[model samples]
Target: MVRLRVLFASCWCFVAAASFSQGDTSLIRAAVLEQWVRALSHDSMQGRMSGSSGAQKAALWIATAFRQIKLKPLSPKKSMILPATVETGRLRVRINNVVGVIPGTDPSAPAVYFTAHYDHVGVGSAFSESFPKFAPFHKKTDKDSIFNGANDNASGIAGLLSLARYFFSAPRLPNTLVFAAFDGEEFDNLGSSAYVGQQEPGKVKLVLNLEMLGRARMDSSLGHFPIVTYSRDDKWVIDSLNKYYRIAFGDTSRTKYFLPDPYPERQLYERSDNYIFALEGIPANGIMMTNDQDLYYHHPADEWQTLDYGLMELVLRRIALTVYQWLKASGGS
Candidate 1:
């Protein structure tokens, strides 16, 4: 196992030494992101199936990482792990959704959330091809039983951890920042549903769900760009809410690129954890890097090596910079 104490302390020191700078998000490190994804998506984690041993292992690691990050726990009983049970008519099994918070200056203000799922379709499960295109080269991959969900959602977890590392050390905001890694997203996105049921919906200031951020291809030749999924009305609300950042994400150009739901026909906005939060009137959206048409999407080929770590770093830094700018403009920084 990687040394969490030493590594996290080094990370903390790296942040502590630097003065907080608005619009300066050099804090995001590709190495750190790589480490996170490598650990979470390692084959031994066994695809992190909900309520499975692999899922439990991943949860424990995330919870420990949260503790190392010094985040306040939301659950009093279970600490950072949001204790919940899934009842499948005949079988009810326990699952943990990891939640940690960076408290803000004002305790009463609505909270901002960073969310992603830590579950995926495990091995031995037959999955019909939605749109299958086998990766041109198997190269060195084991293409066997293990469904290592590296890009499916492990990338999201990596991004969330990077965000936590950045925002935790930055200047304090007026509202709390909650980082939540949910369970059972592959099971019809039910984990977030349970979480949403537990929280007061109106108290959520905003929800930014990170999903599939590792391998991004505008096309085969082109580099990475970001896309966020949100309902039409909620889109406006989110854009208005993040107006302070001057990101101009809604109004895109050739250079400043951000896609507005490329797969509207797929109803992607209603798919991930953000949908559950949005249903409760929370201003929520998911920041995804892919168009979801790729060989390694849910396939066994979706290993850690397939991800574009450099592009992932770039996208995450952009997000951090925007959030920093927003926090500065909001008068809490």
Candidate 2:
């Protein structure tokens, strides 16, 4: 009996050590976040507006990141491009959703998907000259000028890429993983709508959408938490996550964050690409830092310099770890 007790004690110690190591792995440094944000928000990308050359360049960058991570292509053509189109009032333009997949350990296992819209509000309307408040940032009296949506979404794209890198390097994923950088999300979520329309909706078990994570800030009351929004049907999923994860925000137990408030529902959930998937009855949601009340939202002031890189890193790491744990617990394969 004494020998058996000693054996059990040793095993317990090993388990404790392993748990510590796993927590430690959740660290994402500010340096990495800075590099990614800089690249995506660079002026050369011309703000990554939909139907623009900059948007296409951003897509290429995303595809390259997938290749570097060694994720397999999901398309039958073994390519990252999922052909799509967008209608901009009078003009219809063709775009592609950059897609890649990490095959499941068990071929029959259900799939978990990750998505981020790589498009943003392009230059403002020509009426900007009449409304000084709506004037373009980089220039004066310019119509259809660049919005350079650095924090609006470039940050989210970086989070997706970082998460992809983590999963690929660890090579520990059990369930099939699908990573998509969608186009035309800025124009009424057309990209995600297209994706959901094309796929067998029932096959997707969960979706983690990244949006505006770069500018995460600690609210006076909430501490350092990232804003995580989900469909009403995903209450169980959110509860499970809140139970396991340590987030930047304080008092996460407060129902105000997850439940309906006096605020408009569409203002909170309807603006993102995840809404499209959720509408299709898939468990889909998005992570972002903006309270939707941030002063810099969609403004020229929303530049890389204004972002909190350290906080953003923490937010991204938490998201990646949450995804890892979810996949593990769900028997991802």
Candidate 3:
């Protein structure tokens, strides 16, 4: 782990220096990010619980973003919503995954995916009803309860929308780029599981799932860096990222904003959409900034105001740079 951190640090230095000289001026706007997060995390969205009206609304909003970006739908249909039925115990619920694509110059090239789960645990069920663990922190109130999940995933979805816009503006790409906003992730990872199972064989090159990117971990003094978690054998993912950073910045070193997952024991790598793809032997990974012990995690307090828009803007810009260059290096137009 120490060795990997050192490698990443050295590469980041190279990329940073190169970026300054190369004039990579495209930056993620703070207002754009804040708007998306606020819309998704608003009270009317009802925590965006899968199968609920609010979730459907959120899915439609994402589809609108894709349409505005001019991303082609993955299927023959013009619509971006892929609906599925998820079973929980004896109950059945409908969910949707908003999927879009940018066809690559090379038809046979393995596609790269950018994914983020758009669902969250809903409101009303509190300590006395479902989650006893939350009883100590939350107080019973006359007001209605809702878990807005601004950081838990709204921020990730915001990032996905901005990335779609960023890549759509590019002239050419190497390989096909698939953007998936998954639903029902909070309920046993059903959305991503179904999507992965239905894909054509050998079509996936890599999966980069985004989650909880709004706030930095309070435990770290340098808090804003993201944790990039990949499977044990998927070191090539890092190498490819480094390759892109070098190509974009005209530098020989890797990028610095990512660090290996620090709390592997938490099993965070297997806890998101990328895990399903990784299970199928694809080079899958997730980038996020979440700590289970975070005071606001899953609580009603995880609202838009609690988010750090400045940090989100910086992170989104870094992600856009890396992804755009990665596509070029991997054969994207």
Per-residue lDDT for 64-183 in model 3, tens only?
988887888886754688887867666577989999998888887888899999988777663223435445434532264887889989999998887777776665566788999999
Rank by lDDT, descending? 3, 1, 2
Distance (Å) between predicted and true CA of 86, model 3? Answer: 1.6
Compute the lDDT of residue 17 as modeled in candidate 2.
Answer: 80
lDDT of 2 by residue, 185-235 (tens): 766788888877776545777887887876654556655453555556686
Of models 1 and 3, which has the larger lDDT? 3
Comparing 1 and 2 on lDDT, the stronger one: 1
Candidate 2, residue 14: CA error in Å?
A: 7.8
Output the worst ten-in-a-row residue range by lDDT, candidate 2: 255-264
Q: Clashes in candidate 1: how many?
A: 0
What are the Cα lDDT values of the candidates?
A: 0.74, 0.69, 0.77
What are the models' TM-scores? Answer: 0.82, 0.80, 0.83
Runs in model 1 deviating more than 4 A are: 1-19, 75-78, 88-91, 126-143, 219-224, 237-255
Task: Tell me the lDDT of model 3 at 105.
Answer: 82
**Candidate 2 local accuracy as lDDT?**
0.69
Clashes of each: 0, 8, 9
